[model samples]
Target: MQDKDLPDIVDLVREMGAFGDGGRNRSPGNSNSGYGQGGEPQAKPAPGLPAQSQAAPDLPGHLEGLAARARTYVEAASSPNTRRAYAADWTHFTSWCRRQGLAPLPADPQVVGLYVTALAAGAADNAPGRAAPRSGGRKPHAVSTIERRLSALAWNYSQRGLTLDRKDRHIATVMAGIRNRHASPPRQKEALLPDDLIAMLETLDRGALRGLRDRAMLLIGFAGALRRSEIVGLDCGRDQTEDGRGWIEVLDGGLLVTLRGKTGWREVEIGRGSSDATCPVMALQTWLSLARIAHGPLFRRVTGHGKKVGSDRLNDQEIARLVKRAALAAGVRGDLPEGRRADLFAGHSLRAGLASSAEVEERHVQKQLGHASAEMTRKYQRRRDRFRINLTKAAGL
Candidate 1:
């Protein structure tokens, strides 16, 4: 075709939205007849000139980079458990935002405030086949849970270099007001007494291997103030010995019981390597040696054939179930003066039991329990104190 007959590449590029500099199609020249009417070839546009069309910006790449940086900041600022929790919390927040017709980026403070209110109100329905009410429905959430979600959001925003002002402050104040107004009246934790503990321990019939394992598990759990995950992840060979004189080095000090908490495993000193000092650690060692658990999960599921099968670590729910079963077996049932039913015991009861037993130094109790602060320890101690107070009142104190 003649040069004059050829289509304009510039016009084609513009139509195709290739206007950006360095953004040009790489196709070769036209393959039409070489000879033109005037025998002149068409000149191409200067290489420096941008193609008419511009591809969309690298939005996905930008977002991925942002996510990586945010992850790094979260890792530095908090424990792995906290990071995981915050990630989940933020996911909920973003899901809520999508439902509210807001983009995940550039979260408006007003919208954030509304989200906080919604969270506190528990107005967002997650049930299947039930549409969330636009105005009002469902009971409000506990103040503490709401506050935790808000804190997670604020931390997420701060990590992204966003400013948190009146909206955040308003939410904070609302949470504080809720806290102050209710003051929660100090609810008592359901704990097991010494006799109850013994009953639960003894309920595990020592005739069978699984029975012996369960008994050992309950005893060590109560003795060491172990969280469910910690109990399940206990390394019999490394964490403790046949004599119970080893250490339990968790990942993140004792604040979290996840695998990520093992920041090179911070060891907790127990009994002497070889001595008659009766320590709980020693008890753990004896339990391990007797159990003959050389490797795999400290707690195992019993099979139909009565074989102890090695398995992955048990989750928190399994631990709770174990505790509940043991509680039922022990036949210890009665509501305390606080009105809390005796059936409410779970794995956490073991930790609370240890804390309650430590009636001497509160700080020592907190340390043993791996609580971040004494206030948390005090919360655990409140029920015992209330029981004591009631007894004193009954005695005419």
Candidate 2:
């Protein structure tokens, strides 16, 4: 009806309500977009649906829901050592910044340059909470270490929505200067030779549980080229871990360990040794039987009682300590000062031992070590075929 229908039309519409609206056409752009008119009773919104549009989900609240699943992804993205290093690096930087009365968030590039100058000059050795100046004659970090610390800074800044431009002249120029000023060959950890490993094994008496466990750990770590973390992360079954790295299995020919290292999952085979005394599998089996460990972490702590084993897994550091103990007991590096000798042995010695001693192709060694590249594996091959590729011989000099 037209607007001129006036009071009578309004009275009629008001009295009749919208009963006639079902036959009328609604505008295309209207929210309902229903076939019928304005006030026709709609079907119960396809059952269990609201008549009006429900309030939209909170955008930020939806994001909050992702935090738990996102944390799982974040934790898996980097190794534990990497996370620990990142924290330490950040702490060092922030501590230094506090000593200098500087704002750490929006870091001043000049301050960063000064920080590197201090680090290169061995300022880290001084007493804490004291401002240290750059000095020329002091121990400095390896080039690799300095660069990694810088990366940690950049990463932390990124997490806080701030950009730490490492390419900025402040960082790059100072870093280059530090590299040149403190230039030195990389110092690698000492590798345990096969004879040395044998001697270390002899140090552990086969009669005791701790000795049996250590023997197994040393052999398995060396044979499998496992890192300290991987050594302690093994389980009896596949995918049976909250943070456990991988699993172990016994086969007819050898023992198979599927390990997740820095390079991801890879298999390591430790063939049956000639004798039970040196065999990794046999030693491991002895420990397993004695400790009564089944279907959980391969290595764990034993009580002071020496025979009683705890459910708690061994710490990664314990591997290093065990190596140090074995090395000392075996007198493998007697010529060096006691401190220097102690410093020489660590968990890495096992991995390096396999690399240096294995009479196999570089590729095989690389695979066993879980190194992504042969070049990386070569770094750990201390004193191995050093002059094998003499250019003079190749050139017929």
Candidate 3:
């Protein structure tokens, strides 16, 4: 369908505040367990910090106003998801520092090294922080989590115009040692094959509105090879809502999904399937028509006893839960226990499923997935089914 064919549905916009500039101005030594007077947790100020106002006294009033507004844009530079994660990580780090009676700011190399070591040894987990101390005292973090924490620290420091010397021997040596000791092969999610997808779909009640939304989500997500965020971030049409990360357009023969992915903007073409039961386009159209989703988020909450649809978009976590629940109910891997099956399947399974199921060239798969390299796309081609050309058979033995 063309843009002019879109129905006139008013957008429901939600207000969101930008995350504090990584708590750049918060001091580490404020009492109340390192929190402000109002019981709100305070942040630590970076060392060598300059005056807060970017607007100088010498500037004109309007220019100064513009200068002040610049900080808001600066804070908005990072996405909310990213800022939230960084804030949590920062809070945890500061809390650890307070318990250790050490300084969190100035990005001290020796102290940072010790902090990372404690994380690897599980000692940091027990530190009094934003998160409650777990039942088990010392729970070591995974290599990936540790790395993310380090990146968070680096980003937080940069926000305050300070530099974290990650390359310093104290930090670098310990990281290398941690990798040598704790690194393991990456455990990938189990890819859902075409038959597996059909089985999972059978578990959902197609008669209900909730079922229609979910069925469309699963089918579209798999067919478009979309990420969980990409799936829920879609709008019925372009510019329908300010918050939508992407938009959809239905063509005569297929569906076109234009998204702002990690690799930037790209379009995914999902052609019509052989049957209505399995076709992603058909499923999406049915959901949209039944849900009355003329604009705004394509996938939304089904409220009022599964009879009514809400304007609020579904959380990305819902996608993961749905995939797991469906996979478990369908008994996708009958050989495995229920717990393992639940753990194995996730939102990424849909993307990986498409990568595994699509009988196409490597380059085509890579383009569809918007992967910068074929190696990245191949990583999603889980199981032995997608390994179509067997080199062993061609080589004379």
Best by lDDT: 3
What does candidate 1's lDDT look like per residue over 1-397, in tens digits?
A: 1122222223232334333444333322322212222222223221111122223222233345554555445344454456667756766776676566554444356766767666665655444334456565666666666667777766665544355564456555665666775445544446766567778877776666676667656766776677675677665345343312223432322212222122333333232213322234444445456656566456666666655545554455677777888787677664342223445778888888877765678877776666778888777663567655577779888
| Best candidate according to TM-score | 3
Q: Clashing pairs in model 2?
A: none
Candidate 1 stretches greater than 4 Å from native = 1-84, 126-137, 158-169, 176-183, 186-188, 237-287, 295-297, 301-305, 335-343, 383-397
Higher-scoring candidate on lDDT, 1 or 3 = 3
Instruction: Provide the lDDT at 201 for model 1.
Output: 71
TM for every model, in the order presented, reads 0.61, 0.79, 0.82
The sequence of per-residue lDDT tens digits that candidate 3 reaches over residues 190-279 is: 999999999999998999999999999999999999999899999988888867889999999799999988878899999999999999
Each candidate: RMSD to true structure?
15.6, 17.4, 8.8
**Structure candidate 3, residue pairs in collision:** 1-250, 26-43, 26-45
lDDT of 3: 0.77
Candidate 2 residue lDDT tens string, 1-397: 1111011122222223333333333232232211123223223221111112222222233444454455455556777677668766866776666555554645567777877877886775455454444565356667778888888877655543357777789988999888887778887889998899999999997888888899999999988889999999999888776878889999999899998877777899889899887889998999999989887888989887797888878999999999999999999989988989998999999999999999988999988888888889989999899898899989999
Flag the better candidate by lDDT, 1 or 2.
2
Candidate 1 local Cα displacement, residue 151, angstroms = 2.1
Q: How does model 2 fare in lDDT?
A: 0.74
Which is superior by TM-score, 2 or 3? Answer: 3
